[model samples]
Target chain A: AQRVTQPEKLLSVFKGAPVELKCNYSYSGSPELFWYVQYSRQRLQLLLRHISRESIKGFTADLNKGETSFHLKKPFAQEEDSAMYYCALRFMEYGNKLVFGAGTILRVKS
Target chain B: DAMVIQNPRYQVTQFGKPVTLSCSQTLNHNVMYWYQQKSSQAPKLLFHYYDKDFNNEADTPDNFQSRRPNTSFCFLDIRSPGLGDAAMYLCATSRAGKTYEQYFGPGTRLTVT
Candidate 1:
């Protein structure tokens, strides 16, 4: 069985400040990781995936297999960046199913 | 633009009443999934349909059922609504092959009375 964990339930930061959302996972085999974000009044959408190796909306995450972690980071948080973020892990054997973390609420204060 | 759509943005049901939520997609994707999301929690996968093949999570309760009459439409049926069943039910779609990126609908908020 695979599981994802997000230690922080709420993370508040001021605009223009650096922000980091921590995520850890437990999986025996090779895992695919992703970040999904849900903005106020909007449907959940993909933020970034480790395989792409590209940043989205100034945010990036690197998959650390040894540490079993994939943390999302931004150099400077924007007010509009406030949203709920979820970490997800996809096990190849499970087909299309994804195991997700409880999620963390990112609140960017002006 | 191609997109995933869900109907009845909000639904209110009496306890033990049978309720069904609908989802449709214009993207013509091969996979459609149903998820239940509680307050401040991650979306939990209840089941998914790949073409005509239906797959349910092992831990998912038997009270929940799903139907996909065709490639473009799917339905989630709650056999008997319970207070704990009240949550935001989301519908999502994804293409087959190596790309696992999924498109999600706005979701229907179900309220059990």
Candidate 2:
């Protein structure tokens, strides 16, 4: 079975500080990973994907197969960056059903 | 601009009553999905339609049904909603195949009284 795990329920950081949200996955076959964000009063949107290898809103995530992890990171956190973050995985063989993590609520304090 | 739209940002229904949530998209994406999200929990996939091919998750309850008449519209119908069924129903769409990113709507929050 494919599963994504995000152990942190709430993460607090001061503005301008670096931030990291951890995510891990378990799947036998090759998988595609993604990070999604939901800002206040906004719909959940894709923040970045491992396959894209690009940063969005200064957030970057590196997929590590060996560790079975795809943790989201940002060099400096901002007040506007606070939101709910979810990590997801898509099985290569499955019909593209996305398995999501429990999600972490990031609160950047000014 | 292309986007996914879900009607009734908030919905209140009596227990054991039937409720229908609607979703529409202008992106013309070939794939559409419905997910149920509870407080502090991950969004669980209920069902999805890929060009009218309906697929239901194994763990999804029978009371939860979905219909997709075309590429742009999809509807989720709960035959008899229980208190446990109250959650935020999210609608998302992705382009043909698996290369494109999924776009999500603002979601419909269901409150069962």
Question: Which model scores highest in lDDT?
Answer: 1
- iRMS of every model, one decimal? 1.6, 1.7
Model 2 residue B9 lDDT score? 89
Model 2 chain A worst lDDT window (10 residues): A90-99
Tens digit per residue, CA lDDT, model 1, B2-108: 88889989999999999999999999999999999998787899999889999999989999999999999999999999999999999999888733588899999
- Scored by Cα lDDT, where does model 1 land? 0.93
Tell me the lDDT of model 2 at B92.
96
Please compute the TM-score of chain B alone for each predicted structure, in the order given. 0.97, 0.97
The TM-score leader among the candidates is: 1
Report the CA-based lDDT of candidate 2 relative to the real structure.
Answer: 0.92
lDDT of 2 by residue, B23-59 (tens): 9999999999999999889999999888988999999
User: What fraction of the real A-B contacts shows up in model 1?
Assistant: 0.61
| Residue B23, model 2, lDDT | 98
